[model samples]
Structures are given as C-alpha cells and as structure tokens.
Target: MSAHGETPHGAQGGHGNLNQLMAGFALAALLTIVPFALVMGEVEINRTALIATIMGLGGLQILVHLIWFLHVNRSAEEGWTLAATIFAVLILVIVLAGSLWVMKNMNENMMPMHDMEHHMQMEQMKSLQSQQG
Candidate 1:
C-alpha cells in the first residue's frame, strides 16, 4: 500500500527489502574485512589478542548471516530454529572433542617400532627354550 505498491514487513521474519538487505550486506562485509585486514596487515598485534579478535569477529559474522541472510527470528517459530542450531553446534563440539581425545590417547599409548620388534624377539626366544626343555 506504500509508494512501492507493497505491504510493509512486520516484526515477523520475512525477506528483507533492498535497503535492509544492503545494510546487512554492508555490516557483514565490514565484519569480514576488519578481521581479514588485521591478519593480512603488518601491524604488531599479540598472538593471543589477534586470535581472540578473529574469533569474535567470526562469531559476529555468523550472527549476521543467521539473522539477515537466513531470516532467522525468535518471533515466528517460537525459537525452534535457534534451538536446532544450538543443538547442532553442541553435537559438533562433542564429536570433535571426542575425536581429539581418541587421537591423543592413541598417540600416547602406541609403542615405538623398535620396542615392538624387541618384544617379538623375546617372545620367540621364550617359546624356543620351552620347546627344547
């Protein structure tokens, strides 16, 4: 009913108009470019600080993608989409941590090749002495 001959969107989630989409795109681009610039530039930033900054910016970019591009909102579907996303993240973390743990344990417990060879030789000597006796 407005000048554009289309109804205005409400609080409910829907596709964003051109202006809103442009704003979201700008914000997303800014978020991405800042961290990339920081990494690529020769500025003397502490390693820990740089990592934290990159992670924070990455998280913000994810939010921007979810809210703007994906049109995820809390109003329409009673937060089900948000809950599903959280669950998926949780499962992924658990799987990654478990895989890391298993890898670490295996690396720690595996014997050296030389040691295994010595063990096999000792077992064969013991068996031969028993057979001769």
Candidate 2:
C-alpha cells in the first residue's frame, strides 16, 4: 500500500490527475466567455489592435488546453508537442498577416482614379452620341 492507502501503481493517481485536468479545462472554458462577451459587446475598439488581441488570447487559450487537457507539457513527447505548437503558431501568423496584406493591397488597387475617369468619360461620350442620333 502507498501513502494514500492504495497500491503505488493503482488508478488513484491517474484519477486524481484526470480530475485536476478536468478542473483546468473547466477554468479554461470559463475564461473563454470573457473574450466572447468582449467581442459581442458593441463597444468601439481599434480594428487592428482588437484583431491582434483576439488572436493572442486565442493562442493562449490553445496553449492552456494543450497543457492541461492533453498533458502535452508533461508527456514523453513534450519536445515534439512544443515543436508542433510553434509550427502551428507560425503558420497561423503567416496566414493571417499574409491574408491581411493581400486584402489591403487589393482594396487599394481595385479602383484607380484614372480608370474611374476613363469610365466616366466613356459614359459621357456615349450619352452625347445617343443624343445626337
């Protein structure tokens, strides 16, 4: 028998660990409400700053789930787990930032003043020709 009145290799330790992990998951879930509520509220926030904050908070929440629910930090595969996390985060940043860059450029370049003026002139010429005909 071990110190807690169960065999050393008994399931008690595993159960306790599971319970603690469950508690951590519960806390994480509760914490998720904060971000959601903040988003749903109609308060004005800076667009870029708000996006960054939400992304950072989501990344933190993912880390919490990995550490607590998946036991990634304490597992024998900890190194691989950390590497995967880093890779995932890098990919996420690249995707989000790259998409934003592309979208911003598209918005800027989609309608040049020269093209607008040319279209307006064509419409005016067409109207003049129709009136003369």
Candidate 3:
C-alpha cells in the first residue's frame, strides 16, 4: 500500500511522471502541427507522399497517447490494454478497407453525365444508320 491507494501487485509502472507527460504532449502537438501546416500552407508535395506522411504522423500520435495519456503499457491490467488496442486497430483496418472497396466499386459502376451523353449519342447514331439502310 502506497500513498495513491492499494495498486494491484505488478501493476505500478504505467503511471508516468510530469516530465514524461509533458514530453508526450509536446510530441503529440508537433505531430499535429506539422501536418496542419503542410496542408494549410502553400507547400506543394506529391499526393501519395503527403498521405503517407500524414498517416505515419497519425500513428506516432496514437503511440504517444497510448504510452503517455492512456498509460496502456504491458504491465497495466495484465496486458488487457494491449489486447484491446490490438483489437481496436484490427476493427479500424477492416472498416476502412471495406469502405474504400465499396466506394471504388460504386464509382466504377456509376457513369458520369459526360459518359452517359456519349453512350446515348452513339445509340441514336446507330439507330439512324440502320433506318437509312
């Protein structure tokens, strides 16, 4: 029994100090600010590279929150936090992938106005040619 009440045995290492918390906050802020600046500012970057950079920063920000704010270390709750994190990540991946796939298929199936007009014109031309012949 310590001053902060009776913490379970072997589960006392997750709580970080003030300095560590501040460092994590700073890192999270940097992770956020850089992307905001990149998108908001006039910095021209390749679309793919920009997306990759933003995603990488987002992952790092998640790590900082898990370790610092959430205190989701392996020692906490006998690895339950880690397991939950893994499960959540898995669900997110599945949902995002499925949504993208659905949208792509829908886009391929749906024609734009221009394409529809062109197809209609071709059909009318074929009908006229047949009537003349």
Q: Pick the candidate with the highest lDDT.
A: 3
Deviating ranges (above 4 Å) for candidate 3: 1-14, 99-133
Candidates sorted by lDDT, best first = 3, 1, 2
Query: Candidate 1 on 1-133: residue-level lDDT in tens?
Result: 4576555654344487798899889999999999989988956989768867876787788778888888876765548988886777677658766876798799789998999999999999999999999
TM-scores for all predictions: 0.59, 0.62, 0.66
lDDT values, one for every candidate: 0.80, 0.75, 0.82
In candidate 3, what are the lDDT values of residues 31-67, reduced to their tens digit?
Answer: 9999999999957999768867887788789888987
Q: How close to the true structure is residue 58 of candidate 2, measured as C-alpha lDDT?
A: 78
Candidate 3 colliding pairs? none
Stretches of candidate 1 exceeding 4 Å from the true structure: 1-11, 76-78, 91-133
1 or 3: which has the higher TM-score?
Answer: 3
What would the per-residue lDDT of candidate 2 be over residues 10-29, giving only the tens digit for each residue?
A: 55323347578788878788
RMSD of 2: 5.2
- Range of the 10 consecutive residues with the lowest summed lDDT in candidate 1: 5-14
Q: How many residue pairs clash in each candidate?
A: 0, 0, 0
